[model samples]
Structures are given as structure tokens and as C-alpha cells.
Target: MPKVRVHNMTISLDGFSAGENQRIDAPFGDGVGWGDELHAWFVEASRDAAAGKTGTDVDYYVRGDENIGATIMGRNMFGPQRGPWQDESWKGWWGENPPYHHDVFVLTHHPRPKLEMDGGTTFHFTDDTPERVLERAFEAADGKDVRIGGGAAVVQQYLRAGLIDELHLVIAPLLIGRGERLLDNVAEGVEGYRVAEMVSSSSVTHVMLVRR
Candidate 1:
């Protein structure tokens, strides 16, 4: 069966997944000291892999994209746009070819037409519920797994609803005092899950949570 998974969600020691006031210039926002390094390990791992290096962190980083047929992300992850779509010109943060070479459903209140990009990547904007969007993602997955490509809030939605089958978090070594935090207000909903694996590299620590 296909599973819903969240991967490579790097958070700070202060539990912030993203900084405050997200903008086009500052993707993760400001006030996050050393918080930009959250995703540096993934980049480092990719570089290491290109140089024929293999380790636990490298393997974990590479594994996040395996068997992922469709992706679901919040509007924030899509861009800095908010409320209604005043300007429909902004495609996304990624240029011509995005990393997700599959159907990407972006959750938002305002609906828009589907965006077809190069490299077999397409963005479908919808205002549907998380469960409904997830179902659509599964249908598009075509027997493959569905990945929750998030910016904290979207991941929290599915997690609170107990929909995610696996959750992988990359714990950075820094601390952001404010901003969006992973697992925020999810104490009750997180009861059904447990940390199944924890592996630490020199820069960051990787933790995997699976349903009990």
C-alpha cells in the first residue's frame, strides 16, 4: 500500500522549523541565527554522493526522494503569496525544472488552474481538505508513495489527523527563538507515533517516527 511520508524536515534546537516573516528574499525568514544551516547538510550530502561518498546521513538524504510519485505542500512552501492570488505570474521558488518531477498539489484557500512545468513536474492548486488532497495525491501516485513536502503547518495538519505513515526530521545544531515550530500544538495527536530511528552525523541528527 502507498504511504504518506514527511522527510528531511530540518528543525532547530529551539524547535523552530521556520523563522518569522517569510518573504521572497528570505525564504525561511529572519531572526533565525544559524538557522540557514538547517538544509546545509542535505546539500553537503548530495555533494558527497556526487563524489562517490556513502554514509548514514548521505544515504538518508538520498532515500527521501526514492519511490515518491507525488508531493503535497502548503501555500508557504509554494511561495510567499498569501490571501487571494493577486498576481498569477509567480511560478515558484524553483526555476524551470523543479526537484519534484511529479504531480505537486499545493494547498490554499484560493483555487487556480494547474501549472505544467518542465521535466514532468506539474503544480495543481486546490482548496480542498488535507484528506481529500491526500487522496488526490495517492491517485496521482499510481502505486507509488506520497510525500508531504512541507513548511511545518501542512505537515502538522496531516500529523494531527494521523495520516502520515512516516515522519523523518533533520535536527540542526542551532536554535531559532521564534517562528514556526515542528510538532507545535501536536502533543495529543503525536501520541500514536514513536521515534523508530535516530542517527546522528557530525552536522545534524536524523530522526524517523513511525506509527505505533
Candidate 2:
């Protein structure tokens, strides 16, 4: 069966997954700037991957996309836009071709027409609950794993609902005083999951949690 997984989610030492005061200019917010320090390892790994290099710890983290058939993310992760559709001009943070080269379901209160990008990526906006969205995503995923790409709140929603099968968190060493935390108000919390793997790197610690 296809599992719902979260991969390469970077969080700070103080448990902030995203900094406060998010805007168009500051997508990840003002304080941490999309947790650059938190995602440095993956950035480097991505560069190496582009250069045809592999077998590094970062490579392992980057490879999680190989089995993903579709992705689910919050509107925040899509862009800084809020409320009703200001205009259809705002496609997303990513350029013409998004990194997610597959079906990407965006959770939002407002509805929008399906967006087709340069790559195989297509954005489908929905105002449904996590469970309903998951069902749709699974249908879109066709038997492959569905990845939950988030901005903390969306991940917490699914986590609380006990819908996530695996979670891969990259814990950076730095501490952001305040921001959106991933594990906050997560029902019974991570008690239902167990640490399946832990590896430490110079910039971050990779931890994989598998549902029991």
C-alpha cells in the first residue's frame, strides 16, 4: 500500500518550522528566512545532485522524492497570498516549472481552477478537510506514495488525525526564538510513532519516524 510521508522538513532547535510574519518578500517569514540554515544541507545536496553526484547523507534525504507520486501542502507553502483570489497572476513561489514534478494538491479555503505548469506539476486547490484531501491525493497518486509537503500547520493537522505513515524531519542546530512549531497541539503527539533512523551531520540531524 502507498504510505503518506513527510520528507526533508526542516525545523529549528527551538521547534519552529517556520518563522513569524510571513509575506510575499519573506516567504518563510522575517526571522529565519525559510529556515535557510535548517535547509542548508539539502541545498548543498541538491547542487551535488545536479552535478551528478550521489551517496551522501543529503543525497539520501533528496532521494525521498523518487517514490512520491503526488504532494499535499498548505496555501502558505504555495505562496503568501491570503483570503480570496486576488488575481490569477500569482502562480506560486516556484517559477514556471515547480520542483514537484507531479500532482500537487494545495489545501486552501478559497477555490481556484487547476493550474498546469511547465513541468509535469499541476496544482489543484481545495477547501476540504485533511482526510478528504488525502483521499483525493491517494487517487491522484495511483499506488505510489503520497508526500505531505507542508508549512507546519498542515502537517500538524494530518499528524493529529493520525494520517501520516512516516515523517522525516531535519533538525537544525540553530534556535529561532518564536515561530510556527510542528509538534504543537498534535493530539497524542509522536508517542504513536517510533524513531526508525537517526543520523547526525554537521549542519543538521536527520530523523525518520515510522508509525507503529
Candidate 3:
């Protein structure tokens, strides 16, 4: 079975995922607004895990399972764009090499040619619904788990559709106050979730959830 998971999603104390006026220049809000703390967490986690140190479990959680064979993300998560996308020049912020060196499927209303970057990473834009994306991702996953990279709304769509099996959220100490909240209208229909694990670090609190 292919498990759908959201790893290292950063949220604020006020429930905002990102600060207001999310732009290309300020992907995770201005300054060190919301995602700064989370970004640091990623760096540290990567370092420790790669070094075989047991500090934060995030690095282990994200890379522990090499079984994660495929990824599906929203358009916004791929790039910063509102309404319809007019051009395909925006190859994402990760530059020539993206972190995901595997197959990645992007969910979008508008379709664009598949993009292959350095490493084994390939971004395929899909106009189909979340189900279709998941299907394709599962095929690509090769019986491994499929990760759902989000920009909030996309996660909600899959969650409400009861497609997500696990969610790993990293709560930062800061507060956005008025940006896009991750759980805005999402939990309304969700029966509930259970905390599989929780870890407290100096910068953020990592919580793992499994659907009940």
C-alpha cells in the first residue's frame, strides 16, 4: 500500500502556515516571518541525520524511509502564482537542482510540458484532479509511499478527500496572525487524528499524525 504523507509542514502559533502577501521574493513570508524557524529545522535535521547524529528526528523521518518513491505538490508549492499561469518560465525557486531527486508530479489547472532538472528530478504538471495525481504518483512510487507537498489548500483538498494517511507538522514559535492557516476549514469533515509521535526541539515542535 502507498501511504500519503506530508512531511515537515511548518505552522505558526496562530495557525498560519505562511505570512501575508506571499511573493516570489518572500516565499515563506518576509524576513524570518514564518518559515524561517522551520527552514532552520530542516537544515539542522539534515545535518544531524546525515552525520549519523541523533538530535532531531526530522531528518530521520524525512529521509529514514528511502521507500518514498514519488511526490505530488500544488502549483503554488511549485511556484508563486495566483490565478492562471501564463508562462512556464518559472522553473521553481530551487534553481537547477531541487531537493527532490526523484519523480515529482505537480497539480495545476493549467498544463505545461514536463520539466527535467539536474539530478533524477522531473516535474510533471497535471490538470487532472487530486485522485488522478495520486494514482500517477502511486504508480511512480512503485509500491512505496507517496509524499504530498503542499501550499496548504492542496493539502486540505487531499485531506478532505480522505487520501492522506499521515501528516507531520512542525510548529514554529512565531505567529503570523493573518496569513493562510493550514487547518482553516479542513478539520470540519475530518473525523479525527491521533498523535503518533511528538518531539520538542529548541526551534520547533515536530508532531506526527495518523488518521483515525
Root mean square deviation (Cα) for candidate 3: 2.1
Clashes of each: 0, 0, 0
- Per residue, candidate 3 scores C-alpha lDDT tens digits across 138-193 of 99888999998887888898888888898888887876677788887777536767
TM per candidate comes to 0.96, 0.95, 0.90
Q: Mind giving the per-residue lDDT tens digits that candidate 1 earns over 68-126?
A: 99999999889887899989998898898998999999999998999999999999999
Task: Write out the backbone clash pairs for model 1.
Answer: none
Question: After aligning candidate 1 to the native by TM-score, how far in Å is the CA of 152 from where it should be?
Answer: 0.4
The best-first sequence of candidates by TM-score reads 1, 2, 3
TM-score between model 2 and native: 0.95
lDDT (tens digit, per residue) of candidate 2 on 1-212: 99999988888888888788878888877666642786777788777777878654556666678789999999989988889989888899889999989999999999899999998999999998889999999999999999999979999988888889999888888888887888899959677899998988766788899998
Q: In model 2, which regions exceed 4 Å deviation?
A: none
Scored against the true structure, residue 180 in model 3 reaches a CA lDDT of 83
